[model samples]
Target chain A: SAVISQKPSRDICQRGTSLTIQCQVDSQVTMMFWYRQQPGQSLTLIATANQGSEATYESGFVIDKFPISRPNLTFSTLTVSNMSPEDSSIYLCSVGVGLNTEAFFGQGTRLTVV
Target chain B: GIQVEQSPPDLILQEGANSTLRCNFSDSVNNLQWFHQNPWGQLINLFYIPSGTKQNGRLSATTVATERYSLLYISSSQTTDSGVYFCAVGGNGNQFYFGTGTSLTVIP
Candidate 1:
């Protein structure tokens, strides 16, 4: 099992502002995933951050909106740029030891745009 | 992308009751896991069964990869069991898709 810690458990940001959420893992991982969970909705994959390379984002999400930085195997950050009311959601970070192994998640950063 | 669906989106169970949650995937998968997200939004790993049955104290899960479905069983449910349960499936890649999730409410 992997242990993941995400910063800013909850935050309220003004519209048009930007906020960065940090994710730290207990061990080094090759890939880190970011997800968004809107109010009363299921989780949606935002992007996959790979160290030493660009992040792979899912459809309906872009780097300009949610840029990711994977500085190393144990740390990554997801920035929500120019936030809006619709962007208010819980952002989570995930990592897996292997492709076929069980994945672990952070406690998640709850961002509320006001 | 593999589509994942979960049945009984919302469940209300009495304390000490037993319940079963199902997860169905559209394609074959090499990884299947069940998670319980508490009210505080912490996802707790429950099982990592990809093709067999596994048990833990009061929780158990069975994944029939060939059948493209998995079942999670909770026996003698407690109030602490009230939360959203999600099943995530992955194919050959590291990308895992999550199900719609089952919101369980265990009343005392």
Candidate 2:
């Protein structure tokens, strides 16, 4: 299991503003992912952050809205751009150590857009 | 893409009671994981049972890969188990598709 730490555990941001959440892993990992969970709802994947490259996004998410950066194997960031009330949700980072392996998630950053 | 479904959508149990949570997938998978998200919002990995059975403490999980379904059994439940239980699966890649989750409330 990997230890993942996310910064700014919770934040209050105004609409139109953006927030960047950082995720730091205890050790090097091959793949990193970002997910979103609305208030009282299931999680929805936002993208797969690759080390030293662009992130792969899900169906309803795009880079313009959720820009990701994975500068190294142990660090990644997800920035929610142009925030809206609908964008208010808990953002989580996860990683898988191997093929057919279990994934571990961060405690999650709770964002409230007003 | 794989679809994961979990049921019953909501469950209420008494402390020290036992219950079962089921997860169904739309297709064959190489990965199946169970997670418990506590009230404070910490997602903890419980089991990664793609097939067969696994146990840890008072919790155990069984996965029948051929049937595309898995079961999580919680024995001697505690209030600490009150939260949402999510089951996720991956078909070809490591990326998982998650279910809506079973919101379990264990009341004392």
Candidate 3:
């Protein structure tokens, strides 16, 4: 089992500002994923961060808007840039031990744009 | 991309009542899980039944991969069980697609 710890449980940010959320895992992992859950919506995958390579983003999401960094196997960061009111949502990070394994999630960072 | 649809978008149950949640997937999946998101927005993993049945305490889940659906059963509900339940499925890729969650409100 993997234990993920995400920082900044909740943050209220001004528009046009950027916030970087960090995720740390208890153990080393090969792949870490970033997700966004808009108000009253289900979670949507933002990107997959693999150490030593560029994060692969999902459609409708781009690298410039949500840049990701994976400095090592146990840590990753996601930055929401040029934020807008529409960007107000809960961002979460996840990690799975391996194939066919149950995935674990962080407590999630709630961002409110004002 | 796979489509995951969950039934009973919202539910209100009395304490000690029992309820069942359903999750339907559009394609075959390699992983399926049930999670409960508390009011604080913390997602707690409940089950990881990809192709079989798993029970933990008052909560149980069954996944029929061939039928392309899964079910989560909560027996003897309590006020603490009031939260949003989500079902997530993963296909061949590493990404997991989440279903439209079922918001459950349990009252005493």
Judge candidate 3 against the unseen true structure and give its global Cα lDDT, from 0 to 1: 0.94
Better of 2 and 3 by lDDT: 3
- Please provide TM-scores, in order, for all candidate models, with all chains considered together: 0.97, 0.97, 0.98
Q: Write the per-residue lDDT of candidate 2 for residues A10-40, one digit (tens) a residue.
A: 9999999999999999998888999999999
Q: Single out the weakest 10-residue window by summed lDDT for candidate 3 chain B.
A: B88-97
User: In model 2, how large is the Cα lDDT of residue A1?
Assistant: 82
**TM-score attained by model 1:** 0.97
Clashes of each: 0, 0, 0
RMSD of each candidate relative to the true structure = 0.9, 0.9, 0.8
Q: What is candidate 1's lDDT per residue for A1-114, written digit by digit as tens?
A: 789999989999999999999999999887789999999888888999989999999999999999999999999999999999999999999998777788889999999999
Q: How well is candidate 2 docked (DockQ)?
A: 0.75
Compared with the true structure, model 2 gives a TM-score of 0.97
Across B18-86, the per-residue lDDT of candidate 1 in tens digits comes to 999999999999999899999988889999898999999999999999999999999999999999999
Error of 1 at B39 (Å): 1.2
- Once model 3 is optimally superposed onto the true structure by TM-score, how far is the C-alpha of residue A68 displaced, in angstroms? 0.4
